[model samples]
Target: MRVSLILLFVSFRSISGFSQEAEEKKWSSDFSLELEVENQYFSNKGAYANQLQNFLSGAIKPKYNLQSADGKHLFKVELFFRSSLNDPNRTHFDVREAYYRYNKKSWSVSVGFKKVFWGVTESNHLVDVINQADQVESFDGEEKLGQPMVQFNYPTKIGDFEFYYLPAARRRQFPSDKGRYRFPVAIAREDIPFVNDLKEWHPSFAVRWSKSFGNVDTGLSHFYGVSRDPLYLGFNPATGLDLSYPVINQSGLNLQYTKDAWQFKLESIYRTTERQSFVAAVAGFEYTFGNIRSSGVDLGVVSEYLYDSRGLLTFSGLDDDVFIGARIALNDVKSTELLMGGIVDRTKGTQLYRMEGSRRLGEAWKVAVMANLLNEVSPKEILSNFRTDNLIQLRVSRFF
Candidate 1:
């Protein structure tokens, strides 16, 4: 954290010579803050009936931006803070984005920490491994902890190339036993073990190439270093039954083709470790009916097929399953949207139902609703631990 702060200060000072407008504006930088309140209600306490049914939390996000008048240098920082009334593990803070980017004619360089999302499928993001999961924040893995890194990008006729050098990786967060949706055994954060010498400060590297061919957009990338997915060794003398990460090499590909109202997407990854290796893929499509008979309402159908070689042993428990969902866009002034989806296991007869809807209230306020339900979760699958932890989330936000 000290290194990150030093780099940020140095970069900010380097650009001060060119930003004459910044001097004229004095301290009047572009700044904004968003405040949000959320309530999570669980259908049941938990598997052991020792969890909180209702959790209330509030968060604030503040952002600051500075740019040179020539548009060559940009700096931005975003901070996140959350406090929960019920669960202690749910209260945390993160620096989601704090980076300085310099853009030249043919290439760019970015330093510090940021979030990079790289996938086309809605059901899953198999290729997004740059940031670690903030599991205490969300169950779907949408919440990500920032990674400290140095990034480089260069565009060419054949393709656009990007590279990353991650100095350190963050550990995955887990909810406590008193929190809903927790695993049977909560993870211990102190004095954890690593599978090899690739410890927390070990360097990680990744390279990606992306380009468009007609209607298809494709990205191919490779990473070699400490993996984001951890191997949970049971309570024992060697591992102390804690979270241990292994060194790994992963190759990923994401592709999307858009033809009129139809979009076809696919993402796949092949990863190898000292002990094991596997392949996983997600393929899906979305077809939309636009301007439904001049009503300005668009309806879309989404479906995806997820496959994992490990079957029920996989962490996601989405092996050989199908996801079917609908997306509705009201194209109205309030900008209302709704999404509902379900995943069904082909071999185990396990199912998960989910829905989310959000609407803007005037220009400053927004209201959103989300719900998740699990049915017939078999003990053979890993998701059986969350069978009784179905949840509904109500969230409201105000933007300054």
Candidate 2:
């Protein structure tokens, strides 16, 4: 991996020719840097530690574009590196997007490591399975690890079709023993089991078709590969909790329709594995009131229903739950935003509430605050393990 990364960087430098002379041109390479500091405090004591922990991280993202004078052949490279103090695995680097492409009037092909987003639901992503979740970076699974694949896209009169060939998989990272947000028992990374004898080398395939008509957009996709969400085999006498990744075949659909101030969204998936077959879905709608109270602020109300057939066996705490949230966006120069939401498990009467806000400071700096509260948790539910992990977090970031 280290050698491949080194080669990727060397190739980028060679292709871009980022000398002083190249910078004088109209289409030269670009680079940027960002630094971030995160502090988290758990409201309740855990088996690990007490009050506060700090994570100082930095990222250097550089982008280079190679284009012919007529713009027929295009190549692009984007790199990202983030290192943190609290989690050892978080202190790592990744190639976010490095691809070479040839674009024509109706079709394109790209080969490299990239990130693909494929879902519309705000509460839970039921169809976004192309990239692995960067579990150690955030609790909400918003961050994703880069995927290495070859992609082909063709636009037809009715819709667009995309096909992918994923050569290998990247295992999700877990927090260290000292990290704050962790399972009750530490996860042994080496103990993770895979159904394939080749393990991470097992290849995966996917195809997606999407299109938009009038105010409605829809997508249908299928994936055959190792499941991104592993199945837990409960507590093991020797390995704590045994987690295994099973090979699965999943078919998914996502749709969004916009009508005036209202937006409707739905994401559903049916997956089958050797041990289990289940259906899961998130259906939601959002209503936005533009220029609320004649002010520049906009308010949005979001409501969603989450369902999973696995019920108690589902790893997602959202099974058989309802989510309601509000979003406030200040259409100011600072681009400030706030989102507050809660997920209530109807069966267990447990709820997880979250509040997040972010605002820009000056031009290059930004700050974000978030809080998570778990209430009325039941021992029979998966969230019971995280009952004591409820916490508030603050992050400051500076961009160059």
Q: Which model scores highest in TM-score? A: 1
Q: After superposing candidate 2, which stretches have Cα over 4 Å from the reference?
A: 2-7, 10-14, 17-28, 48-69
Could you give candidate 1's per-residue lDDT for residues 60-179 as a string of tens digits? 999878876666777888878899999888898887878888899999999987888888899888899899888889988898987888999999999999999998877777777678
Q: TM-scores of all models? A: 0.93, 0.92
Highest-lDDT candidate: 1
- Candidate 1 segments whose C-alpha is farther than 4 A from its true place: 1-21, 24-29, 190-192, 232-243
* Candidate 2, 1-400: lDDT as tens digits: 5533864776577565634434454343445666777777776667555323555555555665666544555566766666766567666676767776668788988877788999899999989999888777777788887787889999999899999999887777777766656776656555577888889878999999999999999999999998777776466677666678888899999999999999999999999988889999999899999998889999999999999988877777778999999999999999999999999998899999999999999999999999989899988887787777787888888887
Error of 2 at 149 (Å): 0.6
